[model samples]
Target chain A: MGEAIVITSGKGGVGKTTTTANLGTALALAGKRVCLVDTDIGLRNLDVVMGLENRIIYDLVDVVQGRCTVQKALVKDKRFDDKLYLLPAAQTSDKTAVTPEQMKKLIHELKQDYDYILIDCPAGIEQGYRNAVAGADGAIVVTTPEVSAVRDADRIIGLLEKEENVRSPRLIINRIRGHMVKNGDMLDIDEIVMHLSIDLLGIIADDENVIKASNNGEPIVLDPNSKASIAYRNIARRILGESVPLQSLEEEQKGVFAKIKKFFGMR
Target chain B: MNRQKQQYVTIKGTKDGLTLHLDDTCSYHDLVMELEEKLSVNQTNEPDGPLVAVHLKVGNRYLTPEQEEEIRTLIRTKKNLVVESIDSNVITKEEALGWKRKTEIVSVSKIVRSGQILHVKGDLLLIGDVNPGGTVIAGGNIFILGALRGIAHAGYYGNKEAVIAASVMKPMQLRISDIMSRSPDYKSEERNEMECAYIDDNNQIVVDRLQLLTHLRPHLTRLERRL
Candidate 1:
């Protein structure tokens, strides 16, 4: 049986897609056979982020409706085709086209061939969210350090716990600005972790390289030097059952102060 | 005469327990007579006395609340009686109100997500974090063993004495009774230090390190202490 992981966050626009893309790439790069299925039916972005938008002849809805087999709809990623695949969401239809039982059946069919199945959950705690998480063995909630994002993460965690079969969802704190945290101007790592109270996966420091990489349809995990890339790599490693220690706040603050003195002229 | 009265009862298993729906339209006294008659038949079938119970059903006929109470009192005295809704003669506001008085305490084992409000009347204990988008309003003291990082209101019914305690206390908003504080300016180490928040002498909610409350309390004695 393959392990299915759902990447979800209650609030929208908090890096669920970005985390899915980068983590899938990172996991595939680690040689695990991974299939990333986008459950956001109407607004399909996982395909675009994975740079396989042009190759999608069939989508998740077709597979769920039995119009096409899951193997026929599966899009092989050229860069990591041997290890990573994409089950793109249908842009024409809404989330109602797929039921939770159908999604579970689809995942179960893929289980014999694949080792890891990652479902990119839709935003909000509606029917779509339920369908995406229904078949997953576990879940990872993505959130930013902002109060709004953290609140949504908490709510998603609540929903996951209430689900009959879901294991406790873990947390991913993304797009964090280590500098603002040092100045006490923004919510810090401890605060976010304390608030969400899920198992700490790892923290991804805010990096402009991630934006540039996304613009080129490349994931930040490809860049070995970027802090966010390293963090994502660590997260990918943790998913593989490796215990990796997280970077300390003091180390993060050092860069914050250095940037302030150099960029803002604070002596 | 008592043995004759016990003969009319009937029994069947239900989700709650065994139910006995009496013959329809029978008067309360007539239903009692039939219940006794049924019970005598059951007693003869099983010589080893299995505790048999009786219930009466009136098909859509509304009886007075007093009649329902009399039946309830009668059944409660007997062993293993479950007067289900189908058999219940009538329901009164007073009886419904009694069920509402029963309180429950639920421990949130994990993060309470955003857009969800947990309104608990009794002591609320949370094992996990309270994220920012979530709100926890309790009528009693709130204890977050992990973290209280969301919007929290303790002693919600204007009770001045309620305390909100958390291991990591970086809440987005904190309120105790009428006092509301929403400045994200406080800075403390990320160590597992406990914090307690309450209103102080000047009527403003004050949050201090739980360990330093001894030194801080003497200076703010005018502030009321909520137990």
Candidate 2:
């Protein structure tokens, strides 16, 4: 069985789907068979970000309801042949369409065939979040450098701790701006780590390439040269039990190559 | 050890005092016999006679679900029983008898947060602050190393001899057994102090400085101290 990972943030719009898409692709790029499941249901977007939305004929609801086999509903990643698959969410259904037991069963089936399973959890701590995390071995809580986001992340950590299966949840601070943090305009990386008091997975700096990749319906990790892509890839490596040095968001912005990369991408 | 084992008695130590784990299956007479045997063993270990206190761990499985009140009553009369987790699942009679024997010492390792009501059976040793709106009800003593701003009921088994000790005692209310008391309007002069409360000779609960109040709350009175 493969390792099930849920990318969850208690508050809405914290880049959980983006992290899942990129991590899944990065893991596959590293030669591990990965399956990315979008458990957002009605608010599905992992398929769109991975450029596999149009190819989705069957969704997670279909597999859970016994309407289709698990393999038939899996959307293979076009960029990485036989390396990555996505269990796209159903657009027409709500979170209640799938039960935790069914979700566990689906992930159980994928565990033996895949090396990694990334579940893009829904915004709130609702049925979707529960279902997505039911069979997960670990979790990544994505949050922005904001008070409300950190607060909600704290709540999600508390809820996850109550579950007997969940281990210590890792933290990912997305959209971090070194300049803003330096000027005392935004919360710094250390502050978030201290407040959340959890293990830091990796941090994704504010980069326009993320938005660009999303707009282009592709995960940023495929670019390898993109800074956000590198960060997500590092996180993926860390998830696979590797100890990598966390690149300071400040140090990355000072380098000339970063400036040129940003200029070329118009970041 | 074998003689004591036959009596179905187990013993543990905590910051408050000793906690005795009793076999619920054992008859009341056998249970007391085991307690005496345990005390004798302790007497040989420490050269002190029954200096190690005893507390009972009742089997929640054998006790009816509705018998929580009865269990609580038993604890009060015995002035030592610590009611452990109420068994709500499929608990067999034999399993219930064995579970109580393997009870671990109670240790609360996190900050008792708001809206949390934790009823600890044994002595509760808090590693973090007991925040306001939180609660800790222990059948034995409760020792809070940090600020205690919540409701704490220690010696809940009518053990007026039990004590509530904290570094900072700013609790909204405090109770030991059936005796209940609250801070005077939250504006009283004795708001922040290392103090202990116990019942007086007149049977009224009184609070005094740890050094000055020779008699603790829920037990001895100021007059008794002089005596």
- Note the DockQ of each predicted structure: 0.44, 0.06
Question: Model 2 off-target regions past 4 Å?
Answer: A251-267, B1-106, B111-124, B128-227
Query: For residues A1-267, what per-residue lDDT tens digits would candidate 1 score against the true structure?
Result: 688999998889888898999999999999999999999999999988888889999999998887988889999988986899999999999999989999888888887788899899999988899899988999999998887777667767878888877788898888877678889888888867765667999888888898898878888898888888889999999999999999654443357768888687664
Candidate achieving the largest DockQ: 1
Tell me each candidate's i-RMS in Å: 2.2, 4.8
- List per-candidate RMSD values in Å: 13.6, 14.6
B34-114: candidate 2 lDDT, tens digit per residue:
555455544333333333333445553254545556544544334333444333434766665445422223677775644
- Write model 2 residue lDDT over A61-141, tens digit each, in one string: 988888999889999976888999999999998999989988888888899999888889999888988998898888888
lDDT tens digits, residue span B1-227, model 1: 35543323456765555676654455668776565445444444433455444445555556677766766666654444546454544556775544332223447675566666887775578887766667898876677886676789987878676677788887889999888998457665666679988788898888878876556544333433222
Q: What share of the true interface contacts does candidate 1 keep?
A: 0.88
Q: Which ten residues in a row have the lowest lDDT in candidate 1 chain A?
A: A247-256
Candidate 1 Cα RMSD (Å) = 13.6
State which candidate has the highest TM-score.
Answer: 1
- Candidate maximizing lDDT: 1
Instruction: Score chain A of each prediction against the true chain A by TM-score and list the results.
Output: 0.92, 0.93
